[model samples]
Target: MTDHTPHTNHDSNRPAPDQPRASRRGVMKAIGAGAAAATLGIAGISPAAATPDVSLPTDEFVETDGTEFVIDGEPVYFNGANNFWITDDDANAATEERVDAVFDLFDELGINLVRIWAHGEAKEGELVLQPEPGVYNEAALEHHDYVIEAARERGMKLIVALVDNWDHEGGMLQYAEWADAESRYEFYTMDETREMYRNHVETILTRENSYSGLEWRDDPTIAMWELANEPRLEQDDVPNDMDDLEPPEHQEILGEWIQEMSAYIKDLDDNHLVSTGSEGHYYGHWEDDYPDDDWDGQDYLEHHSYDTIDAASFHLYPDHWGDNPADPDDRLSLHDGADYITERVEDAHNELGIPAYLGEFNVNLYDHDLETRNEFLEEWYDAADAVDCNAVIPWQVVLEDTQDHDGFQLYASDSGSIIEDYAEVVAEKSGDWDGDNGNGDEETIAVGEYNTTDTTSDGLHNDFTGDGETTHDDVTAFFENLEDDGVQDNPEAFDFAENDELGFTDVVELLRQV
Candidate 1:
């Protein structure tokens, strides 16, 4: 497929366009497997049939059990990525082929979960899923249906974010603009705008898929419903640092909105989990009404507000959030960022007693080497693992074909790519913590004999190209084994890498130690 120049006025906040739309032939080819399965009555099989009696529950609902997510009555953990643009009209038009390609890559990387946008603001001359207040776009909704259907076919789950807090996609500010309100915070207080938002949520929850003949509320593929993407009441009109009033007076408004929206979603779809995508910010000393240093932290304020919210969601952007190294000239390291995330995870688990989600996080490639970024991710993952955080979804998973405007893209074809290694580790670690095994021990594979011509050796010692010693030749053979057999088959052999999972990092570290 050939690349096309993106529309010059395309929203800068959105991801770059995906590879030119897949051809009709490609679409049919991708769908052929699903079609064939359906013909054989094998598609969309019931959850019970897919899992063994002893396995974790595979039902439609995702519930919480004290800082852990329970699915099918068993605690579960996942590693996910945000692909917000998948449902955007400007990119792949949410076509089956494009969706299939994206899921295909995810499946290859052992990524069983994804987070996508369910709402796009109405804007003139732009692709807005909701073109106006109280209006529905059937075509855009159909695209979303395709997304759910595609995810089902791949055995993957989705986190569907209902709205954006930013104006880039017709968020709260847009709604306020429509209602002629003085500030975006009015979206919570104004009856008219509040009703409009409720109506939109109803439309989404009650939506019926044209292709699958199933209502969205009944679909098991949807892991959870996010009220909004990083919602905050502090916009330009109602900035966070205002004087004359309490520094964080907007907490009440934000809290009310989350409570209302969360209750509405729960009432509509009691089967699914719901969350407020807050950034997990803590109030400053002056902002807190009490003289005590730690009185009324944001985590305590926002997380404790709504009984209906199932989990606490937060984002981590060390560089963007100014949590980087003291010296600007020095490349940003993941060490400090990892500590910040660890603190947040500990607070959410120990303080709030709710399953915490690192919903959005990433380090820009321009500021750090790929190795450093990988190390940063490793630290964050380790922190989450220690605290038993429910899920960790990085900022994004851009495909190889897409043009990367920022260094956040994790998918690359390069042999030594750390992102590739990170994905493998995530895949492995996700399965290790089902809560069924109290020890949190991962399943290990007996390293098969490496056959030089039918090479015969076991463990990491199966160096096909060399005499008994592990050398650079073994590194070459290791990657070859990955291509042929995959990391799951010899996790111990692959454990040489960082992040506690087996991958290229092991090979790099092996060479370094020798």
Candidate 2:
């Protein structure tokens, strides 16, 4: 949060555009109609096209190997900024100017990704995406459309998160209220609330971008879809009998949601990658065993291990977690913070076999000296490099100067320059990679070669009932248990064809493995 303003991601804590050459931003446009350019252009971001037909390259879409982010067969190392306010409900020329300048600066700085919120429901204002259950405000959507179209124009990829864990901007609590559920937790449990969530997801994904004339589901500029921003709940968030649902273990509640939601996203769009958008709290490999880690009820290892989650998303907030930037002796020391980066990044790759993303990390200018802040960031960056982390984005970078004084805001003209410098250094040598994304050169593996190491109930163990090996017996078991709750919950694990669905074809592919 900006000095506890808006929504800042991670810390298990609380939680645009533009008028220049704005796109028509009409709804229901085809996904391929992005040729419609902005009427006016920003200096750094995509400006208005000189011609009516601006053909974009089809190969530009980011391809993932589940270990790295790749575009056009080459692996990519992303160093980008996060700006959530570009799509703020109250849009004016200044807001558009800010968006233009930030994107312009990021493009000039060689940063490649922008993670922003696709979810927000303001309680007091008319500017909200989903004001009520299944209802959307298109006027508010025009702002969001500008953000996407502007990025697309600039050749920038985005990691768009769907919701927030806290109630910074009318998060899950608003959904619960709309559904008449008592607790915000009902947003995940109640049938009515769950459907409402799904409706929002579909609306966001399928809605046509007014400027780009492209449906969001088909937009290649979007690199990934996050289920939520730092999704987790405090232990006090118990299930209300009003939903008439049994309760899961504190952590399992979120774990279940992550698994289902990620899988659901995968079911809808195979073109883009999806993640939990959690702060990558650990379930398996935990070092400090800090009690605060448990406060959010998130299990990083378990959450990322789900079949459809393409990468591990986590954040770094040393100051909030326990680090007192003034007192170098704080428990979440700089060194410890660096170690946090290495541990999560390495664990995600070595254990779960997916790329680990440091979704948000920052040094609050209000809390530390410029020297201390730079050193803190350098330490974490080095750790990320050493462990081969796929992507490391700071808390946020903006163009406005007044916001620079906030707890985590980093304006491009000021503290954000620090990241600009860092991104420059990482651009040339950075090379954390992705898995094979059907390059057509991969060798055919034997039936038993579908390897997996998810030992717990949270993972996708190849071994049906026992050892981590697939066999005819396991296929038979799969057939028998097709209707079982566990199989129904995680059919992707058995989907040998690698299609994003679980159906008769998946069962046939399972049989072929035998």
Candidate 3:
């Protein structure tokens, strides 16, 4: 069912009256005593804080207009990088220096968001496998603390995942062993099993102490809680029950898990938004037998649209480990594909009438061609705006280990710069940066201009192409035509050429074969 709550709202956690110094000390003392910040209200806030409020809805980053994720009463445009595989089972493999550097650089790139995965083991503290005892340190908690504080300090939001369910992963195996050495985790279907997961999440949500004396439940920079990562079956698992559970029981079971946990999260921490980890378009726990499953209470409807996968959705590269689609150019284009996904996003928005998000999309920066990569992102953003997507969180941001042949970063180093850049971009496209974060005054300027025909058209919707053209007359004409006698329903039919993907020779050619 659709959430009837007003979508527009101000962040409730925004300190009213900006508490005095002595009051800050009292809040700190209470926190030190292990008091739940969710109970204290403004009396609990420090002089300067970015924590999520578990008590009030507007106190966090999750205020919505019954339709999309909103920030400070305005619709949010999440523009950030991703960091999924950063914290592996082995802490040695988890480059701390690189992680710090990555956060530093993210600030430089004008980014305002970072998506990190909390693998199953990372969540349960069991994944790390190593030579010695504790050698494989599941530094998930520590790393999460670091990212939360770092992102907040830099004015960037964090989309943190709670579980990773791709391979025969760590946490799942541990849980299975806990149930019975032979059973493959009974919780996959049991109600008690789902409740256990919910309880664990609730514990985290209610906790007031996590990162360096910081409380997660009230952190504004902490965007949303992800339920799990790509909870889907792999190629080798097709023959096994992993592809789709037998008797079609697990589909309903898993959907219930999502719904339960989603509700649990919303109830526990009304301030922050919550989402299931991005699920694959096909053969996923969410898609299997319940092909007709469609629920709407969750804040974000996340999907991982890659290039491959026999069912539906876009393609994912490098992992295209098979001999299909043998054309080299087709493969490369698919690797950097975006327009196709954009069109899909457009359709989803038009059809679903909900806030959709691209949870994770990435390529090895050092290996992928720069021009193609840039093109993909440009196309993705264009389509996102066209459809009013809630957010686009790319994978693996700011890790020092990350490198490009050209020596660049997916993240910026100066946090303020990135925040400013994002604020500017969002402001330029829409009006303001949702001012409650103390981001400053709203600037008024018509977003995109149009005309009956092309006359002095400048680059209004031409951001992705960077062709330097979005003028008044063209925009005016485009919208005018959209409102014409016969064109009432599908305003998307307007021919704003520069923003028109079908007419763009390069884009058309890119999608021609795919």
Candidate 4:
């Protein structure tokens, strides 16, 4: 009965099951002896019982760079939790009651997005089996259903990661053999393995739940399919024992294969969106061509940043890669973490020309180094908002007692500040659209009759117009319309005009506001 899992900030508010039944005496007092006959009917009605929830529509989903999920022309945000509960740990069981409690907490938090891991490796005993057709694992599949159903009940959205290369003891590279013909890990570059991954994805997309009796392929519950969790350039551990390396050739080949599979997944289940799991620390791997590679079929760019993410991700953290380099200025004392992250984010907008997300971030609550973690996150939130960055998904919510402690989960002693901090920030950042005057300063961009769902040029939200690829002028036109209609909304609507060149950063600011 000893708790093995790393304690998260599970408190009185920790997600728990719905109201427990009254005592047996009280139940008997109310129902009397007639309850026996009613129990017979409970079975038939239980599965068919109607619940207050909405299912996502089946159709190609469009998530904009500004973090909008447009399904059949409507916009939504995926505000959910990061559930890595399905791993083969002692605590790795997903019960319906536990799932229900998590869902209830999400609902309470007004969260609509959920991040679930779809680890692709098989396991031998408790150890992970590289490329072992993990899809065949019954427990894994069962947990998947439990998670999906829970999200459905809350009318939440999902960001599904196809592979979890970052978490297990060995990391994704350890499973490279499963990917390699010579190794135990199944590599996607291999046609057979790729096909299997594709088939498995197809199964998830097409499979209907015996519980909800609904298929997720067409539902909004699916936000996007992330290609891998922190996919890297190397198929094996790095040369210097460092986490990253520039495996251009390997990444190029792997990127192409991933793109093909991405396209394949999209083709088979056009209803939902598809993307890669957060790219982890390998920022150099992504390029302008990255999106065109097919893996970028969707609008969102999911990336991870800690203290190192000064450029692309607006979120900052306590430290960067490697042993913390001593800041000569002791910059840690200035709370300039937000500025650092924003500076990098701005550069990315100017360089890459796409909106980015600080997809995952959090401080280990149990870390004896709690103060550093807390201070780091405080500035991160400010930086995320200061630069108008996309979204932030903290590390995790709850931990199961069945799991061993690893310093990741947030226990009741730790999570209070972060949970409340994030909640407040999300609320305050909620506002009207604004325009970006590309030179760097943000301005008020009016909301015009831009139909994000339409393929017309000149519309604020149109990426493809009949005239050609959508242009900034088209976005400007939308703003003009909005201004004319007195609907000029958030300042995130307008693009910055640099010698008359309009770009997506401006549009994303506007779109995010929308």
Highest TM-score: which candidate?
2
Q: How far is candidate 1 from the true structure (C-alpha RMSD, Å)?
A: 13.8
Q: Which stretches in model 2 have alpha-carbon errors above 4 Å? A: 1-59, 239-248, 284-293, 323-329, 429-514
Across 255-313, the per-residue lDDT of candidate 3 in tens digits comes to 55565666677677766766556432332343422211332111122332211100111
Query: After superposition, which runs of candidate 1 have C-alpha atoms over 4 Å from their true positions?
Result: 1-59, 91-93, 124-127, 239-245, 286-301, 323-334, 414-514
Task: Count clashing residue pairs in model 3.
Answer: 57
Give lDDT per model, in order.
0.60, 0.64, 0.42, 0.45
Predicted structure 2: clash tally: 15
TM-score of each: 0.68, 0.69, 0.55, 0.58
Model 1 poorest ten-residue lDDT run: 46-55
Error of 2 at 508 (Å): 65
Model number with the top lDDT: 2
Ranking by TM-score: 2, 1, 4, 3
Q: Which is the better candidate, 1 or 2, if ranked by TM-score?
A: 2
Please tell me which model should have the higher TM-score, number 1 or number 4: 1
Runs off by more than 4 Å, candidate 4? 1-62, 65-80, 86-92, 124-135, 166-188, 235-247, 280-320, 325-355, 365-368, 399-404, 427-514
Model 1 / residue 48 / CA error / Å: 32
Give the lowest summed-lDDT range of ten residues in model 3. 304-313
By the lDDT metric, which is better: model 3 or model 4?
4
Candidate 4 lDDT over residue span 121-172, tens digit each: 5444232323355345555565666677667554466777765545453334
